[model samples]
Target: MRLVTYRRSIEAEARLGVLVDDLVIDVATLGERAGSPLPSRMLDFIKLGPVAVSELGFLLKEAGGRWPVNGALPLAGVILLAPIPRPDKNVFGIGLNYIDHVAESAAALDTAPDLPKQPVIFSKPPTSVIAPGEPIVHRADITQQLDWEVELAAIIGTTAQRVTRENALSHVFGYTVLIDMSARDCRRAGQWIYSKGQDSYCPMGPCIVTADEIPDPQTLDLWLTVNGVEKQRNNTSHMLFKVDELIADISQGITLEPGDIIATGTPEGVGAGRNPQEWVWPGDVIEAEATGIGKLRHPVVAG
Candidate 1:
């Protein structure tokens, strides 16, 4: 099921729903119809865990296929929110996962800078998250070189610790599109945190696709376009360290709690790679998509 958090109107509170085709079946409404009351907020449902998902599935099945066609719920009238709008912790993102990206970044680094033998991980503050179609603040003064990175983000479903690769995927909730917006200048100034933690830098979601739907996570096609012009294009198969390894590696010492998101890095074609580089400016729009997941488009605006 493609689960979403949306508001019917700008002033209305956000509600959780499951999107089927063009229609959205409000989960709360369905629960009410079934003589039960569910928390209207997506965060509440997320906290409810597998029980909530199973209950929702039962409700949909009990509807006997009449619920979605009722036209009482209109998807076009709603405003979408980030699937898990305020994750419990900072988003963990891997840098240079794709071979091409690794090569490009290596070349850009000051000669033979002792790269981390393990995954170079960093965190993006939760405040950075914005929904698909939200505006990405382009801080022109703070950052002259703003770049886009289209990455596949894995959503953790349950708490995991010392999980082996064989059992790693079982802990995954699903996948979604993540645009790791970067400020090249700040990233070069010092550590990655400052550049990566800027507000509205991480734009995620159209909806979260349950892991069952995607049989193979590593085979998906991922791409990004800036104002209708294609930029980053590659497959998840190109990842230097696969999803399972990433999870196991990251969780070795640190515990990965529920709702933690891990962005599995981007492929080549970043603006900084171009001979005459191109950076995002005010009024620019970026659209990023991953197979089976969906699209995330955000407009860039001067801060």
Candidate 2:
């Protein structure tokens, strides 16, 4: 099941729905039709625990056999929000997890690409999130050296602390594509927060695919593109640290709660590493895609 949070208009409240064949079936409407309305928000649904998964499982099973489409809405008619817009906590991030990305970043800095013995943790505030199709504000004055990072975001299904790598996957709800849109100015000033936490800096979610669907998160292929030109092409398999390790590492002292988001580090090929640099310009379309999850496309607009 590809779960989504959406709305009819800018003023409308976010609603939960399941995406099927480019259409969205409001879970509330589906529940009403089934005489049992499911949770109405993405976080609420995820918090429902296995019940939500079971509900989605039933829906997917029914659809596979022959969908009982009664109140489905065309996907084109609604606004897609980050699966959990206004996330309860800041988004946890890992920097330079991919070997090649580490190498490239080091090269750009004219330093050795020594791998981090541990994950390089960072965070992006909730305000950074923007929905797919929304424009990524190109802060020309603040940073013409804007960049893009296509990543696979893990949606936590339940609270986890001191979890072992072996059981890490059990806590995963699913995955979605997140483009870690960046501004380079503040990063050079050693202020990653301002560089990454700007409004509309994180473009996420076409929809969240259940963890059950992705057998091995590390096997997934993900990439980023500028307009129609493919620049980053790498697989999760290339990461020096895999998903399970990240989960266990992150949850060691900090508790990961349901609805929390963790974006695994991005792979090689970013604007900063390019020979002459390929910063974003207004009107450029950026796209992030992962094999099983989905694609996230947004245009850059002058801010």
Candidate 3:
């Protein structure tokens, strides 16, 4: 199931829905019809755990995939917001999780090409998130080096702390596409918060695909394109620290809750690693995609 948070109009409240073919099936309305009302907020819905998905499935099957008039909308007619528009906490990020990305970054920064013994975790504040087709603010006055990193983000379904690698996948609810927008020149002594936590820096979600559909998160392909040109292209199989390890490793000290997102990191083809170092400027378009999850297209606009 492809879950989404959307609004029928600019003034309308965001609604929870499931994407089916070209339609958005309103989960709240569907649940109400089935006498098992669901939450309208993504976070609340996610907190319902695996049983919520199973219940939704039963409701869908009962309807024979045909939703009532008020319970469905054409996909194009609604504004697709970030699934979990305002994450309960900062979105966790893994840096240099891809071996090739680490090598390229080291070469660009003139450092040793060393692999991290564990996940290098960072974060983007909740305020940084924007929806699909939203504008990525290019604050030229703040920093001129705007960069993009396409990532596959895992959404946690349950509270997890000190879990083992073998049981980490059980805590995941689903996956979504996330773009880690960075301001390269704004790095302050190697800390990424100022460089990556600016407003509108994280563009996430076309929709979240439930975990059951993608049993093996490592096998998916993810890629990014600037305007019409492909810049980053790779498979999740290339990640040095896979999804399960990341969850287990991070959970050792910090607790991960439902609605928490972990951006599993990007591949080698980022702007900073390019020979001439390309930067995203006003009027540029960035489209990022992960298999099973959909595409996120955002335009760069002057801030």
Candidate 4:
């Protein structure tokens, strides 16, 4: 099932719903009719886990036929919000996880930094998150070389620690699209915090598909286009360290709680990798998509 969060109006609070075809079924409305417990918000539904998810699926199936019955509101009238608007913690991101991306960065930096014998991990602040269709603030004054990195993000379903690669995927809730917006200028200064943590830099979700929907995570085709021009194109099969290894590696000591997101990194063809280099400016539109998962589009505006 595809789960979503949306707001009917600016003054309204975010609500939980299920996305079926082009319609959005308000879980609360269905729960009320089905005699199941109603969750106050999207986060509440997430906290309820698989049982709640199953109950929702059953309710929707029972509702049968068409959705958003007459007199009921249509999903088109509501503003689709990020599946998880504000994640509970930082978003884990892997760096240099694709061979081509690694090679490109190595040549661009010309600094041949240690080849991260293991997964090179970093994180983006939770405040940076913006939902699909939202505007990405282009901090013109702070950065002239704003760029984009399209990545595949995995959502954790349950708390986990010291997990083995053999069972790492069992801890995953699902997958979604993550745009790792970056400020190349800030990154050259030393740390990734300023480069990657700018407000509205991280754009994720339209919805979260349960792990079952994607039987194999390794074969998805991921791509990104800027102003209708393709920039990055690659398959998840090229990931230097696959999802299972990544989960096991990250969870070795630290605890991964439900709702925590881990961005599996981008492929080659970033703006910085171009001959003369290309960068995002105010008014530029970015669209990133992954197979099975969905698409995320955001416009660039002055910060």
Best prediction by TM-score? 3
Instruction: State which candidate has the highest lDDT.
Output: 3
Global fold similarity of model 3 (TM-score): 0.98
Which ranges in model 3 have alpha carbons more than 4 Å from their true place? 110-112
How would you encode candidate 1's per-residue C-alpha lDDT over 14-104 as one tens digit per residue? 7788887787888888888788777677667766677777887788778766883332367777899999888889999998787778766
Which stretches of candidate 1 lie above 4 Å from their native place? 68-72, 109-116, 188-190
Error of 1 at 263 (Å): 0.7
124 in model 1: Cα distance from truth in Å? 0.4
TM-score, cand. 2 vs. native? 0.94
**What would the per-residue lDDT of candidate 4 be over residues 34-91, giving only the tens digit for each residue?**
6776785766776677777677777778878445442135667878787889888999
Q: Write the per-residue lDDT of candidate 2 for residues 1-303, one digit (tens) a residue.
A: 789999977898899988878888778777665666688899999998878789766765665534445457788898888888889999998888988889888987443479999988889999999888899998777986888889989999989999999999999999999998778765854547788879999899989998888979989889788879999999999988899999999999899999999999999899988898788889899988999778888999998
User: How much is 180 displaced in model 1, in angstroms?
Assistant: 0.1
How would you encode candidate 3's per-residue C-alpha lDDT over 1-303 as one tens digit per residue? 999999999999999999889999999999988799889888999999999999998998899977877889999999999998999899999999999999988988553589999899899999999999999998889988899999999999999999999999999999999999999888888888989999999999989999999999999999999998999999999999999999999999999999999999999999999999999999999999998788989999998
The residue pairs in collision within model 1 are none
Better of 3 and 4 by lDDT: 3
Per-candidate TM-scores read: 0.93, 0.94, 0.98, 0.94
CA RMSD of each candidate after superposition: 2.1, 2.0, 0.9, 1.9
Q: For model 3, how many clashes?
A: 0
